[model samples]
Target: MKRKQPLLLVIIAFFVLSNFIYNVPNIEAATKLDIKAKAAIIIDAKTGKVLYEDNADELLGVASMSKMLTEYLVLEAIHEGRISWDQKVTINEFVHKLSSPYLGLSNVGLTQGEAYTVKELYQAMAIHSANAATVALAEVIAGTEGNFVKLMNEKAAELELGDFHFVNSTGLNNSDMLDNHPEGTDINDENKMSARATAKLAYHLLNDFPEVLDTAKISRLKFRDGRTYNNFNWMLPELTFEYEGVDGLKTGSTNFAGYCFTATAVKSNQRFITVIMNTKSQIERFNETAKLLDYAFANFGEDTLFEKGFVPESKKTLPVTKGKDDSVKIATKDPLSLIIKNGEKDKYKAKLVLNKKKLNEDGQLTAPVKEGDVVGYLTYEYDGDDLGFITDKESTVKVDVVATESVEKANWFVLMMRGIGNFFASLWNGITTTVGGWF
Candidate 1:
């Protein structure tokens, strides 16, 4: 009896230990990553796939992050030849007063009656988050900060950045502007944007003006007067919150914004953008961003689900009405590459959409089919919680599908025979229906 009792106790202990070990990882996997912020989002930089989001669409103050749009406009003007980097800009008395160190705002002191080149002010604005430098650049571009705000709003609309409003170029709380707030805006107005919209702005900024990183990545910049300023983004190398592959982007903080950051990083050739808004503190923003980024890099990798020229089994051939061949083989014009979560590959499926303009009334190609002709689009579907693209609510990421080989027009006699056969088939169907009705 004693030996049997010991055997029974051993069995029970073994079962309990095995179950505890098995459930530990399952519990951690279920929780995944959690970001502590008012709003947050992480997305693939190239494909705009939303990996994770929490209250990303809730509008919140953006603080100096508004300068990203201003930065965009400045780059656009330079590219369009409307402005030059070497062009000298005189600091107005208003900006000079606003830039005084006495105010304790982030700035590079600007002296009145001294002209600074556009590039100098840009470096100050980009590297130091200098408010006065931002306003100076705005004035150079639009003759006044108020007019520049108009351009900012217009560009925001054009970019389709929903849930955004630009009240000023500097993104300063109108109250902080010391009674010099831009015209047509209330004194309390501050730039506001949802995390999603901010991500979109960063997307466009990187795609349209990739060189912004050249400046954004600079950790320290020296003004002509010899005052050096360090970048506020501590994620940069040698900074306090350094993270591998961390690069150019923007950071904002205010009484209302509560430490917002738009951060981008690349690892193993895969790039991701993360936005954290309204974190508890400056360090908390970077800590939360690190958590989000680690989640992305550790759990996701670049995958080629379908290679170029690959054809879907269900949609391998498109019918041709008058071509020598009755059908044409179609394949993807480009590879379908995505940064997807590991082990979730089976949940995705390709969706092919044929071009309606290329099809005839019978839903077949009309005549000669040329090689490499665009016949449709190849998109994908994931049976998971898809937060959708950051740029738009309903837009789907897709690639072009095209014909793999040419199908020349059929001979005149062959076309005539096919037409005759189709006509007879239609007539026979009609005659059978009429006879049935009589019965």
Candidate 2:
């Protein structure tokens, strides 16, 4: 009795410890980061999951961040075989005038009557944010800057950037284009977009044309005239800030737009895109971006909820009626991953939900089901406030549960044969049991 009492106490203690561990909630405390900008947003580049946002939907002048879209269109045109890098573009009087230093615009000093290749103009536009080079490239692609601006708007619409509008290929304000307004448009015209939409654009641009980063990473390049053009992005190493993982993105500032930056950084296979619009100063844009990046990398990480074609171990097989097999295996069509806060992996739970209405009276699927047929969905959810995730929103990941193999319906003859086999097996088992009992 004394020995049994000690064992009983140990069992009680184990139950108490287990209950405490299970009942204690993991909390993701909300973190507050002060960012000084009119609009700012941070997103996971791969997942497109927004990590932080402030006035992100508020529309504002984007300034030269518009160049991201311009560069994207140029790359698209190149990939489409519309133009090649070595193709020389003539320096027309219009472009020459815009490239002049007297206009107080960033230019690459293109000489009138002289021709430069598509590669030179692209380098100038991307590295120097040269307005003239941008227009030259636009003219080459769409025949006219106005037409290219139309294409830009079309692409913006296609990208679902509802709040974006572009009046010119260059993001120059109308007032700055007083002498250059050959089209006679308003001086107030400038490209406008929300920080959120601009981040989305940048995300697509990087994912679609990763080569843009190669050009954007260049700190300095020489024009055909041997004149040097320097990149304005300060986030690169040996630049103003020297952020470790910072890479190819754009910066913009105008009297109307103030200062704006779309920055991307990668570390540990995780990439983050940060956009800051209308900051007080150029330095502040980089500073605020650094702060945002620090917060995201420190607090957030990703977790895989399910691998492609993965089914929960317990639910490997599901009931199937009127079929040759009594059960069928199932799996998900795609891998399920989510951007979760650090130390919150254990809080996530996944459930397999079947389409019960499709089941027969016995709660088993009918036959003639093909492989990859959708049976239901596997939903992943988190129940705690530790991650600060929106509880009212839908599940984090929902993958389609599919049949692993086709199950043919059982024929009448097959069913009769199976019944006969079961009857004979039962009779043999009964005879053996009776003989053993007699012995």
Worst 10 residues of 2 by lDDT: 385-394
lDDT against the true structure, per candidate, is 0.90, 0.84
**lDDT (tens digit, per residue) of candidate 2 on 1-439:** 9879999999999999999999876543346567898998888877677778888888899999999999999999999999999999999997888888998898889899998999999999998899999999999999887788888989988877767978887788866764564253566778899998898899889888999999988877788777876788888878878888987799999988999999888889888899999998989988998998898899888888788889776588789877899889999988778887778777878788888887887878998778988988887767764322212234545788899999999999988888899999999999999999999
RMSD to true structure for each model, in Å: 2.6, 10.6
Steric collisions counted per model: 0, 3
Alpha-carbon shift of residue 378 in model 1 (angstroms): 1.4
Stretches of candidate 1 exceeding 4 Å from the true structure: 5-7, 14-32, 393-396, 419-439
In model 2, which regions exceed 4 Å deviation? 1-30, 182-185, 307-317, 333-335, 351-364, 368-379, 382-400, 404-408, 414-439
Best by TM-score: 1
- lDDT at 373, model 2: 85
Which tens-of-lDDT digit does each residue in 17-111 have in candidate 1? 99988877764455356788999899998878788888989999999888999999999999999999999998889999999999878999899
Model 1, residue 230: C-alpha shift (Å) = 1.1
